[model samples]
Target: MPYVAVSALSHNGLIRSHNEDSLVIGPWTLCSTETESPQTLLFPLGTPLVVAVADGLGGHPSGDVASALVVRRLARIGPLLDSEEAVRDALTACNEAMYASADDDPDLIMMGTTVAGVVMLPRAVLTFNVGDSRVFDATRDGLRQTSVDDSPPPAPGHRTTSLVTQTIGGTVEFTAVHPHVTSAPLAPESRYLVCSDGLTDPVTDDEIGEVLRVHDDGKAAFELWKAAMDAGGPDNITLALVRVSE
Candidate 1:
């Protein structure tokens, strides 16, 4: 039998006043939530399961609103995401929905989010992203990024940048997106990390890999959160550790 397990957490970090990161695990979603401890969920490998994070654009009004809308929409459509085209269409719909929502509300204009996550099928996993959030393959070997970052190369001494070339919705006008989509065969065992940049921006990949190597899935999720908090916790942090076993 094949099964999937996800351990996740979200926090406002030390510097952020509120958590603008939202997450969707299957049909369950979290919005503007604070969760210091790792919460684990299990499911049989059947319907397509989406594990993703949405990071609201900082310095923009109603960031939380944008992120929540994106994640909730994903949760509603997770099971229907069975193919690459389906995933792409869903993301496109999400982008359009952002603009639609913004149009209906004056304050929501110029609000947007960066999204990244994995869609786990029975025998394969599809990884997708927009903006600079990330999905990574995690194992004893190390962490390998599976999603594309939409920002320019970081300057010297910087791990990440604040400027994003594309996002869900940041302006009043409609902006199309070419989401990065890729698929890999699911092995007898595999693990993936889907997270907002808040986790990756402050913590180095080496540190994250070390924690994953030393800890189990659930504990690794907690340790990763702690590492970000220890490193000044500059932004909203949200993450999920997904494991598939047969």
Candidate 2:
């Protein structure tokens, strides 16, 4: 049997009054099933799976709502879909839903969120993103980030590196969709980390690796949050760690 240890924390940070960041684990089960079904499966087709994430959107009206919406949408993919086309279609559906919610609610105007999530398959590791959030692969060698930022076109053609150009419900129209999706073979004894920019921006990448190196899931999570707090936690920090064991 494969076991996934999930540890997560959300902080208001030093500057923000409210936490705009959110982390999700097993949300697929939570969102998919209802009163009729007591047991919900996130990936019905996979044997060993770990899908999770962290989200951070610029604190705007209903940022929290937007984050939750994206996480829930991604979580409920009934069975694993191997093709990129299927995943892209799922993202498009999420965008439409988010846009509709924002348009319907006056308070949720301009609501948006950054997402970083992972999909574990039988033979490969799939990580994807829509903003500045990131997914990192942690192995005995070291840690490596998988996704790139999808910021706006830098100068009509080029794209910005650090800004968040595409996210859930950021635009009035349902267009301007930019997704950073990629897949790679899963490494043996490999661990994965998905987090919001809050954790990456305040805490150095080296520090993050060290924390993961020294502790298990719970301890690593606490240490990460502590480091961000020590650095004045300018933004809400969220982290999820997944270790694949044989």
Candidate 3:
């Protein structure tokens, strides 16, 4: 059977005092099974795919906690399903998990994170997001964004960016659940890049595509982060590269 090759890393950028970004790669068992060892924090590459990045709300208390909780919830997903609906359901579980954590900690109220991830199988690619963090499809023609930003588009005469209209734990209302989820067929020779705004906000899509085109997936992920840091590294940087192979 063909397998997905996944590699990821998170860093505190030039400006941030600490990295609030979190990532989850590989099976949930790996995360839970080695709690007492350093391996608890890392996962091996071969298995049904689950790779994601979470950017904690910058101003919120326990922002790192919020992001880590969300990714951990995703890691816990077992008996994994490859369909789009299952992906949505999994996200819902992440939302609830974040909320439950917030409920326990007074300081964490309204705390949330931007989540973007991909579930890949030989037949398809299911991509999702719940904030400005994004996922892109890299094709021979170029890189095209796959998920829509949950934030509103920049308005006329407005110079600054806006917040995500939907997120994992922004509000208590049930209908506030993020509606920006979509999936489509994975193109052979096509490469998927899932990242937090740390990378996109600083680097151009063309640059991202060019890097992937020139390097292997693991190196591509690293080069992308290096470029962002070179460009001043304004925020936390993260990138995940998943290539569909023959």
Candidate 4:
């Protein structure tokens, strides 16, 4: 049987007054404003595993609430995610909950969050994302981004990308979230990373690949966080690294 080793970390970063990021790994879950020292878990290969990260949209009221709602919903729905349809349904339920909450409170109105995660089954891993938070596949070939960003590409001669086009609870009007989802066969020597934009905004893909190549699961996670902080930790950083083995 294959086995998976995982490590996760979340930090408020140097500039943020609060951390509006949430995460879940297997049975454990963390809400916004909660920080946990890096923790490692090992799962027997055939067991189902779910890991996720959510980043609250800055400049919005109760951003922490929005992000906390996302991961908590996923944690509740995690064990039952046995198929692609099930995953979609779970995400829809989360979206609806966010929308309903926003409708019920003026302070939470227009609050939104980005979500990215992976569900590991016996044979394959399913990856999904909404907004700019991401999932990446790391192997000897290179680091490939598996989740698509909802933001538009940067314009000519400009480094700035467009704002996120899709998210949970960004508006009070009825809107449907279409998450990007994909799957890949679980293979030895491969690693998957689920992270908030806080990590990617400061750390380049090549730099990420280099760190993954040089370290094991826990160390890689720590190094990634370090790199982001070294780059000034402009936002809240949250990530999970999962490594597969036979």
Q: Per-prediction TM-score, please?
A: 0.98, 0.82, 0.85, 0.94
Q: Per-residue lDDT of 116-182 in model 2, one digit per residue for the tens? A: 7776766677787778888888776777888786654456643223466677677656665666778
lDDT of candidate 4 over 146-189, digit per residue (tens): 99999988889755463889987778675888877777787766
Cα misplacement distance, residue 52 of candidate 1 (Å)? 0.4
Ten contiguous residues with the weakest lDDT in model 4: 29-38
lDDT of each: 0.93, 0.66, 0.72, 0.85
What is the Å distance of residue 65 in model 3 from its true position? 0.8
Q: Point out where model 2 deviates above 4 Å.
A: 28-50, 54-56, 151-162
Encode model 3's per-residue lDDT on 117-139: one tens digit a residue.
78776567778888889888876
**By lDDT: ranked, best first:** 1, 4, 3, 2
* Overall local distance difference test of candidate 1: 0.93
Q: Tell me the deviation in Å of residue 145 in model 2.
A: 0.9
What is the Cα root-mean-square deviation between model 4 and the actual structure? 1.7
Q: How many residue pairs clash in each candidate?
A: 0, 2, 0, 1
- Which has the better TM-score: candidate 2, or candidate 4? 4
TM for candidate 3 is 0.85
